[model samples]
Target: MKRVAILVETALASGRNILAGISQYIREHDDWSVFHPTGYMGATDIAGLVDWDGDGIIARISDPAILKNLKAKNTHIVDVLGNVQKSPFPLVKCDDRKIGRMVAEHFIGNGHRHFAFLGFSSERWSFERQEAFGQSLEKEHGQVSLCHLNPRHQGPAHWHRNLDHVASWVEGLPKPCAMLVASDQFGPLAMKACERSGISIPEEISIVGVDNDQSFCELCRPQLSSIEPNHTRVGYEAARLLDALITDERTSETLLETPPLSLYTRGSSDTMAVSDPALVKAMRFIRQEACNGISVDHVAESAGVSRSVLQRRFKDQLGRTVGDIILSVKLRRARDMLAFTKISIPEIAERSGFNYQEYLNYIFKKHLSTTPVRFREEAGR
Candidate 1:
């Protein structure tokens, strides 16, 4: 029997999802006793890990002393938390660089010329995301305004002051700007900043954050758009690495970055940065009702414009017709569900406003260059 210490915290959805992946690994194997720490555990607590005697251990930790102790104990370790820059254990983490580039391309595709990034100066992960975002924009001959806060100083006074600085940054940003936050936790903070400046979202400023923390994303005033990192794949791959180490079949791989699932759009970034009232209204209408089988005529009527006018305006401003925008919205919804949920293809088709499963397949192939099932497979891994 292989006694394994699974010292992963379950406080956030990401952590819990990692545990789910580990659980999957255990189910496929035999005689593996899993010991997982539950509830709250303090950082830098050696006892939380040292008390357990296991043949192999998989933990998301950062304290150097703890790492030294684990190394002395000679148990296999796989570090999922990449916050520690140089740990002896192998690492399995999300690709923050890819996530950053993905968000940049999203904003650029939506016709956003002005951009900004919200993050913590204290965190290495945040810095990495910010750098990647900047590089991607530079490739497109664009740049971003940066507002990074350091949360090392704890207190209400410090938090409020940070919020104020964020507000000041927002107030100074160019109009019709698109902002990318390092994580979903800070999405609402930026939104609050916007509120302080009396700025409207998806009109003056559109926000997209990384790490699609559902609670943070949904609870925001306009709901947040965020990049969904594949937490399950991180855990699953970490467990696999640990298993390999346990079996004395360790390869040269020391760090493996799991790819992001997809960017889920919500009210925060559902519209383009355009000033045409009719075009904006048409976009708003299409985003809301596109999955309800609405057509270009319906979108035109909702915008109080004729179909010809709406299509012409869409091409002028968004470089696409009304039908393209409608199809894009529907595809985004379908893609989100495919990557994040277990909804069936037929059900996804109906919910995405497709008349039949075959039509959904046709659209997926014609647009995404792959079938829905294949997309799900790639996203899941």
Candidate 2:
């Protein structure tokens, strides 16, 4: 059996999910033995592992010395980190460009015309996401503003010191703007800045962040919405690459990119940018109750409008009917479960408001052009 060393943290949910994927690959193949020295952030001490003589290594390399030491060992290695600086090892990471495009599409679908991106200046991934998001909005004839934290303002204290700057930038944006923050950590800070400036969320401004860290997302004043990256797929692909490398089946240093699962919608971005209060209420009700088997009539009643009036208004403002909106929400949820969970298709159908698995499959094929099983298989790979 090939012995592998995993040098990734277990503190963040993303990291844990990556480890889970690696474990899953090993379980399925039953040919690999894994070792992870865990403590204090779960970072492996390279010096301590120098003599371990592992056959292959999967690591999130943060320090230059880690690379130097691993190179000396001459073992097959795969990098789970997507650092801007190119490394000698193959990379497995989430597709940041696709993530940005997804965020832009989500905001545009909500009738938002003005957009903004909030990120750190020093992070390459953040810059990539910002650039892609801006390009997407531009293609749709929408405008995007940008705000990046200066590199000098790096840590918590410096970030707090720049709250006024963040507030100023946010306050100057056009009303009813949707903003995408780089990560969940930066999201709450932006929310705090907005709160301090008395900007109304999901009304005057809406915020979305990357990495759906549930605790952090839910802790914000309006509860932040976020893009949930498919880290499990990243890990699984990383393990597969490393296994191939160790077996001499692959030699190229390639980058494997996994698409994000879905956007985890929340209170922070629940409202559309349209001016109709009735339509807003209807959309909100549909999003919240769609998975409970609610119908277009229920949405109209909840919004205090007649079904015909709601249909006309929705078509005018959002370019879609109420039934379409409900189905979209259900389909999004179904896709998320299929990608991120091992739940059975029948259970997914029930949870996503479909009465039957066949019905779900039919709708998936009609709308997504792929069956649920095929989608899940592709995502897992």
For each candidate, the alpha-carbon lDDT, in order, equals 0.83, 0.83
C-alpha root-mean-square deviation, candidate 2: 6.9
Residue pairs clashing, model 2 = none
Q: lDDT tens digits, residues 151-179, model 1?
A: 56434567788789899999999878899
TM-score per candidate, chains pooled: 0.74, 0.70
Could you tell me the TM-score of candidate 1? Answer: 0.74
Error of 1 at 52 (Å): 1.8
Runs of candidate 2 with Cα error greater than 4 angstroms are: 39-41, 44-48, 63-66, 150-159, 251-253, 275-381
lDDT of 1 at 62: 57
Instruction: Put down candidate 2 lDDT per residue, 1-381, tens digits, no spaces.
Output: 999999888776778889989988998899998888776568656765756887999888765777788778788888887654767888898899999999998998877889998897566678878988999989775668988887556666787777878999998998778999988878778988988998767766888998888768867866789999988999999998988888899467588889999998876886678667787677667767899988878998998989899999988877888888888878877887887689999999999999799999999999989999999999892
lDDT of 1: 0.83
Best by TM-score: 1
